[model samples]
Target: MERFKIRVIVTDQDVEKVALDVRPQTVEELKEIVRRHCNLQYEFNMMYEDPDFGNALCNLNNMDEVPAAATVKVVPLITSVSPEVTSNSSDISISSADTVILPSSSRTQGWPEVFSIPNFSVDVEFRLRQANLAYLKDNKTFKCPWDIKRNILQVLSEEIYKFDTYPDENRLHEVARALIGKHPCLTEAGCTDGCSGWKNSLYYKMGNFRTKLRKAGCAEVSINSSKNTPGVSKGLKRPKRCEVNFLPELPEREETLEAVRFLLAEEMKKKNPNATTVASKMDQTFSLRRREIVDVETPVETLKERWPALFTERQVFSEFNRIAATNLNDFFEALDRYTPKFVSIFKTKGGGVGETLTEFLQQIDLRKQDVTALRTLVLRGLPVLLGDDPSDFYKTCSVTDDDGVWAQVSIGLLTVVDEDAPVGPNVIHLEPVSTAIIIEGSVIMDDLKSLPEALCILFGLSYALHLDYPKSMKNTLNFIQKVMLGLGHNKLPPKLQSLKNVLLS
Candidate 1:
């Protein structure tokens, strides 16, 4: 038995931070300290499940008696061992070396855990960041609803700066070094930051923060992607300048996330014993152009350059100005559902997969409410996917192959859900054209936005799969309708708010 110092913080009567030493026999005890000490402010999220220093805690706030909802339902999505249940699973044991000792910084003034819904990515990193987000959402706000927004912003600020939860590049490299025998270097491939695309992240070594972490960092020969670990210089290889595959018959529904989630979910669970249903539920929460704030410590004024429309929109998108605006979540979902799943694999012309992915990440921009709506859509899609006949409802990333010899397509998607409404969910969708499709024809280019969702889905596949971005842009507009006819709004209004005010809001 080993003696360890444990501090569980909660808002007891006043803002109180509790510290105690725990002699834990098994891994389960780490969780118990969190549950009991946390009391009303409970956060037992496992960022890095090291069997070592008890489990890491989520950011907790406030103190209160157990509310009725807490006892009424224990929405158990992820599995856990019951302290009272005597069984094999409950016999918790942890390794001494892996325990997460509260760092000196964490003990004095605990830092938060921040996450981002990155353009390219990894699952573990995403989940690690999300654990704090889960706390932000679940934790209670101040009694006066007036304090809600301020409280959220405060939490957001703290969490976004929470970088310690997930590993940086050096950390990931260390893990890779353990497996590969040396720090792998990039040689031939053009580097784009890792675009694990959907469920991955770009990380750097804490030590390497001074250099261009996104570029190739190799002391010797370059490491091929199959052998390299994630978040490192994600390899991007360019295939010969190829024509877009001419296969017109591939069904669009084949590439949607609904089609892919289950297969991926099974694989993900093997790696994460605890990331069962809870993680899946969190995945359901993101939508087109969703931005989970990582490093929230950065103030809003700094983000204003990129997110100018937010403060300005309550300033820019009005019936006064003719600026066009559509439901962000809906528009992105539309694109995700109908867009062709394209890949610009490392074989693209002199480019590597990393660069291809970084390009994808750079294109995305979104409004806040739009993301919340995506969660609703994904959650709704989950049940259907787990059930039968879910193909028609797929996300439309990629489906029909181009009869084997056709050129590949590229895909980009945005799903935005407006969270302001108390009644039901709302979303908007968006997609941007890659440069490859420009060569297709003048006719397609003339009416780009009029294209249908399915064709746009097809067009998006041209990027990473190494089709041409310009070539597909023209082809993509084949179906986008300018006027959302059924929504009681014109295609492009003389004034943007005139359209938004009528239906979109």
Candidate 2:
């Protein structure tokens, strides 16, 4: 059994040691155990300095191969939004002249996740060469030369002034570390783990960077600036980290509809004999008719009230169900394409050999067929199949090849009373179900239609499913309410219109 231990560092400057047994458990299990023991947030990520690759994202997939007694850092994610900077000077302060110890809390605010930064690409070798930072030729001691550090600071000074606002201290640390790690000489100085010596060195560089910018007549706001004090972010309050609700003004409904109609009219009039003459006349009229673009600034509540049918989730789902059921055969066929083996079985042998639909019906005494069992199976299975229950794996057959699709085979057998003449469709007399049973059937059918079937099932089942319903379908659910009701006025091809009406009714 391969066994190893690692030092785990938390964001709150706490450290713990964790042992790993790679023979039995995977790296994912190791992370879970570490996460639970450390009390880290679920969203927190892990990183390590590989002997071969330097600093890299932890490969939880191959923890067994990692050398024993390695150290890993648990870094908090810097969300891709404006972060709140504390007003307390002592909490975060950068000296204008010399080195300062960066308060541990300062790392909490910078963009730590490198990938989130727009256009960020690290070319460590080029950076090291350009900065005069030394690389290990053999087994040399990891020490970043002073001249290299001074040159790096000079570069940082130029880079700082180019920024519109003061860069976050954590961002500077990350940027410095990226360059530092490439130079193997900086490893002993603790650049890989973002050591105190390296951090202090980076901070002094930033202090000089800020000082140079100030002296060059380019005044800059520091990240530690008080929100109450007037500066670059005078009226700027840190935006609340709530769900983003962007409200972009859109062209007015009437004008957009007119534009669509104008384009559609051009297409329709193209087949006319005097096409060129008509086209010019239509273009002239359309130009004259076009008005200034008005923007929709209506409240959501008002818009929902204006078009109640489009806004309600339940109603839209119901419509989708109704639309799907209109061409039920096509819908099932689409669903069948998703299950090729099952379809092949049905198509070749009428059903699976021994458990065939014909065999089940043959054994059934029409005089005493269990209606209760049939109804219970469907009622119980349909919802569980459509719902979010992971354990409902057994309910796969209820929606696909059930009575909804096999209506001719199953319903026909239920109607047949005589056992001798097994295949007489016209003479079969299905016993009268109670009005309650009929209603139950209707309810189950309704629920079946409203099911959130997969997109493949919708499209693969029928070509007719591709009919243009509305512009709302192009975007995600959030945009549904924003789509103008007038845009839905485009007449769906006859088949889609019928399907849509079934739901509306």
Candidate 3:
């Protein structure tokens, strides 16, 4: 097996933690596949280097040692020669500047078991250009495999302005999680094992609001009034749906509902010529309206109340209170300091919640015939939202099947049993988006495999269009990030079963 180096860039932009090294091996003949497996052109590129690090070919027998995963320490090299030339070549030697070593304590323990392909050789040939760096410059390295306040400062900006440097462990974990690719929880004794290195009441240990992040998945409840409900003298009425009052509406896959509203209104007018007068009467009845935006400022008193959640003693809060003098600006600053904590608490997916809904319905026995109808009714209005299927992959079903598009979708099935609250008629369900696309289904799924059945259920659910569509272009960028984590460095497809041990270990 031939070993090739790989570099994954973990940026500081709104991320928790990321790693830099991986080892992968491939055949010299079908080398192009390597690019597909890990490259920026696809969803896996966000975590990759523009000038990727890997060999061109894999030697035989040594196949087991393929460079499936490695963490990288990205250091910027400024040389006398142009930076471009240095990257253009396969390798370049640089004069030593300051060296930052990972102190071995930084690695977390116990992550999940992931998979990746085996090692291979490289057949690359390139000339090396000179690389240079000035000794006067400062260098930074992260996750130095160490646990120390000093080292933490090393990774952050040196020109220290007074601010709360400590977020919580959960927040820190999440920040690390976002910044790094598939990380382990931190410890004084670092455990590099992805899934089973260490265990504790991590969620409970990190208590209070300071400990929780948005990713822990907040509970949401929506209150809405409907006109079709029973009235004092009226007979039984048709049920109306309750809507969610959302802030900065949840994101869409590709198309906007606003674009189609005009046409729909026109159709309604055509169907009822006297509709204007009827509409006036209809308006007098209950109508839909946008949720009112609340501009109430987050209070300092609220922060003071929440501040104690981060620590045992009020010392840290007291120190900040001393500086900010109990003012709103100080509270806002405190909130910013604690922002990192907010992320870590949520990113950890919180329990087996993904399985909770399914577990509740595990005993259900849906006959083949019933599932077919349920799927049909459930996906009725989602054609533009769920997306169309390509020959192979779904290829972003939420976007318009129009020419160029990118679509991202998150789907789940919710069960219904109560007669009083039977699943009603909305084929696909979605919340408004501030970012990201989320889709929900209410069908029993013992067999979502048969091509005909899958199509029947999923085809029309594409109502909102794919994420690849133009309106959702910004959110689609995240697809690249998630895909990278799902398949890049140490992440291999199911075929590479033999290499699974090392990936999660």
TM-score of each: 0.17, 0.22, 0.17
Residues 263-363, candidate 3, lDDT per residue (tens digit)? 33443445443434433322221111111111222232332232221111122232222222222133223323332332222233235432322322232
Cα displacement (Å) at residue 324, model 3: 43
Best by lDDT: 2
> For model 2, how does the per-residue alpha-carbon lDDT over 1-505 read when each residue is reduced to its tens digit?
5577787877333789887565325666666777778854224456665777665646444765556777777754332111233222122212111222122111112122341212111332244544343344554444445444444453443333222124445555555566445444555433446444655665765554443333232212222233324336554322111101111112235466456545544444454434444333333332122121001323333323332332222333432323222222343333333233322222343323323334333443535535433222222222222222212111122221343422222100122122343332212122312111011122112212222232212221111111221222222111111111111222345434442343244
The global Cα lDDT (0 to 1) of model 3 is: 0.24
- Which 10-residue window in model 2 sums to the lowest lDDT? 239-248
Give the runs in model 2 whose Cα sits over 4 Å from its true position.
Answer: 1-135, 160-164, 189-196, 219-505
How far residue 281's Cα lies from its native spot in candidate 2, in Å, is 36
Q: Which candidate is the best by TM-score?
A: 2
TM-score order, best first, reads: 2, 1, 3
- Candidate 3 matches the true fold with a TM-score of 0.17
After TM-score superposition, what is the CA distance of residue 384 in candidate 3 from its true location, in Å? 28
| Candidate number that wins on TM-score, 1 or 2 | 2
Q: Per-residue lDDT of 1-505 in model 1, one digit per residue for the tens?
A: 3334443333212232334444445434545655565442212342221223343332222122211111111111122222242122112221111111111111111111113211111332233345435445663211212222122222222222222222334433333232112101211122343112111112322212211111222111111323344456544321112111111111223245434434443443454433344334223321100121111222333333222222221221220111112222344465344222211121131334344333333333324434433333332322222222222221221122121211121222222112332221121223312111121211112122312332333233221122333322321221222322112212333433342243333
